[model samples]
Target chain A: MRKIKDLGEFGLLRELGLFGQKLPEGWIGPGDDCAIAPKSGGNLAITTDLLIEDIHFRLSTTGPRDLGWKAAAVNLSDLASMGARPLALTVGAALPKNLPFEWAEEFYKGLRECADRFDCVLAGGDTSSAEKICLSVTALGDMEGRSPLLRSGARENDDLWLSGEPGESAAGLLLLEKGLSGGKALEKCLRRHLCPEPRVELGLLLAERRLANSAIDVSDGVLADAGHISERSGLKVLVEAGKIPMSRELCACAAKSGADPFELALGGGEDYELLFTAPPKNREAILEIGKGLGLGVALVGKVEKGSGVSLLGEDGREMEPKRSGWSHF
Target chain B: MRKIKDLGEFGLLRELGLFGQKLPEGWIGPGDDCAIAPKSGGNLAITTDLLIEDIHFRLSTTGPRDLGWKAAAVNLSDLASMGARPLALTVGAALPKNLPFEWAEEFYKGLRECADRFDCVLAGGDTSSAEKICLSVTALGDMEGRSPLLRSGARENDDLWLSGEPGESAAGLLLLEKGLSGGKALEKCLRRHLCPEPRVELGLLLAERRLANSAIDVSDGVLADAGHISERSGLKVLVEAGKIPMSRELCACAAKSGADPFELALGGGEDYELLFTAPPKNREAILEIGKGLGLGVALVGKVEKGSGVSLLGEDGREMEPKRSGWSHF
Candidate 1:
């Protein structure tokens, strides 16, 4: 890929323009000062996230396409966590002086792919020069008269669940570290790590049906993400170690690498899966929604009256995890 | 100042909790997974901007407080140009590993002051480590039943106008570069440059009343900013150079420094003023609104039948300005 500097400023924008196409619902997309979308009621959900080079991803291991995908995914995940329908996004990119044009083009291509898949429009954004690459995306969504599912809404006895398998991304990272080529399934895992899919549709379904009491995206690993809900809701959470879903391929890969699947499941970051809590009565409904959406749903544990998180091991012993998840600071 | 690293991840958020003050109606201020605000008929005005160290501002000249203020102001300015009312904002700051904690606290203090002034709330944001300082802010606002006032809305014969004086920032920059210090009047010019107040209320009023034919913020200098409206609106803008407002202090400082005041007025940036165009019929209404707000309004030009921007000098001769203004690339 060409460096971003080769594209200059206007050139980079022209490159971005190619990827930003028409939206699914005739929504005006990127290139405008800001995007406009119709909301069910009168409220709009907004969220922003920043991805710094080296800090968020390494150029050597992650491609520009993956970087772009992840940048949008992180912000979209935030919107999804709120149970808002993704509508539009604006990106703020700070490119290094020596960046190549092709790199930027590929980056936007990846971002466009994600936007198309989710039926969202690429809205306006700002671009500037920096010492290193930094991408900040702000996503806008429609709430549609539903109360946003917040991290502070989980009640005691609420069943905790995740949208998909937890440890695939971590397992992929381990394989990459071991100098293993991501062959087929391994590539899929690596892609999952680098370019996570934001559970937008599932989140909308959950909100539409009023099934989820609380929700958060798992960018900072399961333990840390769950910890966020626990801290916000003033409740304790207990995870059944054996019940946490793990992909068969991921388990095999973890075993081969002599890594603990449980540890990765607890502390690995960048999963981007929706971790949510719902009442016991809503279990079947949530399961049906997940099945209809083709999204994996795992019954991980339950919310309790206390504070902090506890792990119940296979031997029926409670243990505190060695560490929480990734901390940005 | 305590170093940000000392606060860790959640600790930093805990620190942010101290600034969780209430906001105007319909604003769900920061702290949740995402921010939500009421929009006019369900449409939102959203924008995101990033300020990188050295690239956007120098720490030596700009204080932490002003840095915080300007960071929010830039994005707020974008929303203002769209005629949106300030709602809530989320900040993402990447601090250098060595930054002290007190700096962060003071930064937030300044940010809080500005947010309060604008009736905005400090929503949740992210903090991380970087080699140099970088701040990214995303602002969301409500349009309140009006179509966004875009740069593409100008038409021929429309009168171009601006709020307040121009070139203050440029004059201040010159003074700072020359190490000139300490006159009360000079200090005002410097403060204007350092902590620009976005014309949010004026923009909102103009949009709500449908008074502006086109609008843009004076961020990249009048010529360049006007050039955007010209290009987007496909209208020729003939700016009357002698009519552009200039503060007496700026004029005197420029004269003392043997600099051309016209050049400064044309090419100086970061003024954070509103540059807009309106129909001749709406001129009286706009002037009344300006008077009601106690703000200065100057009619500087008229839209023409063609494209591109031209300036009429003091001698009634058209002249191309030497500087086009600041370019981020």
Candidate 2:
């Protein structure tokens, strides 16, 4: 057997790949954020995420409260991707000794508030002191007997949809980087960046209604998330650049920063919007849901027979953007 | 309200404690490593722990494999405390870019080996880059309809038992710190420190047989863990110092290091042995289970109608140690 040292991280992961040869029925192991236990009779969805200081957030702009909220929100986003209803959350934080204890309290307050809003319990967590602050959060959800929305389920010609505006958080981040001195547009973007809400209800609605064939959260950007769906489903995602929903606030923030609003909407990350695929027949019903829920749900693209992701201009011309999305690795 | 800074981290936690009064049935809101959702038909126990570089372990001494094993082991120890059967694990690691990829692979390999040994699934986890290597693992288990053993369940006159030697890990750490130059004795202590095995089977037996009233894993040494039971159960734990089980190897290590073996057994942490309380009448049943499992189970003390923990020296004199056990914060 080859030693893991020679294989590298990804390579070793590939070799250790879920130990698929031994998995039980309904067990979806390691590759996904949330693993489904088939033996549970299909009632659980669990997901986890890590957020480190500097890498995940800049202390200059984010305080403990925002940090706490974002920590829970991101993992909740992963649950949403699985079309899971939040039930409880477990948090783990490593703080520096000099950190104001009050700051940690503020962070918990934010986490509590988010959990409350989601009707989830802030069940348990471990806290310790470290050289720098880091957070790990796990969100557990009830599948309610519904099959999860997998990234690899899109059928040919399935319409791509967005639960809300994209790239707002990224735009907000740019504003934060520029100094939080902008107008309402920048403030809105900043809030979006600081506390991007996950589309839990929308995800639940999709799963319950059996509307979405494939789904993922737009944490890494629309194009990048779409890539996961494309690669997993073995189909091409033809994104309509003009069709991606954008708030006037996002546009104004982009304008002030001299950045392209469309590009921000397409390639920027951390919006926590639901990016999903549904059969074209369900478009009307999905749009009705958007109206009923008072949340924007727009058709932004379609799944094609080919593979990978391609963008189309309003004029129906294929265009290539500068980058796909943010990558932690 | 006073600022959190005024409250300090501990006060802040106390203020934010559990959020239990607000939780619904089947919800165990915080305060424990694994929170039980009583509604899961009483089948689940969930727990998480965070380990950071320099604080939890020195990267210079601990290779990635041991780091991974310890990360999983510590959380598993928590599950053992609850008498929950290991089911699945979700891990989140923040790695530095400069970290050798091979190290990460070795870490996963160790994680895989441990999970496999325990019949638990390494279901899923997230990986990201950070300034230092940090690991967070969440262990999910099924309690199998057996009520969880709480740290607060001990009653007056309940017999306290230790599954194995206490402070072996702590002694091992001392040896490691002193440099493992002694003979097999030092090597044994070092191994105990680096790879302390969790008493999962014994915990399961106790829970299943109703042998223990309150149980906890000795991660922070017998005194500290007993203190948890003492405080929670609102009773005094009278530990008989001479009764604490210690190996000949530990005595040798202590002689060389000039440390008291009894003190090391009492105050050293990370033994990962079970410290539990049981009725005196169940001694025969407990002994039988121990014999069946071929594991050591020795009565170390008794629970009394008081508060806090007090140690009686070999000569029956009360002794107060300078510290309880290891504390991360």
Top candidate, metric TM-score: 2
Candidate number with greatest DockQ: 2
Give the range where candidate 2 chain B is weakest over 10 consecutive residues by summed lDDT: B1-10
Q: A-chain TM-score per prediction?
A: 0.85, 0.93
* Candidate 2: stretches off by over 4 Å: A1-22, A39-42, A320-323, B1-12, B18-22, B317-323
Specify the poorest-scoring 10-residue window by lDDT in model 1 chain A: A26-35
Give the alpha carbon lDDT tens digit for every residue of B1-329 in model 2. 35334544345557766534467866655555467865444467888888888878887667777767778888888888888999888888777776666677788878877777788888777767777778889888778789888888999999999997776677778777777665888888877877777788888888988889999888777898899899889999989988988898889888888898887888888888889999999999998888998888999999999888889888998766455655466
TM-score of each: 0.86, 0.94
lDDT of 1 by residue, B245-324 (tens): 87888887787667888778888888889999999999899999999999999999999998888999889998765547
How much DockQ does model 2 earn?
0.46
lDDT of model 2, residue A10: 45
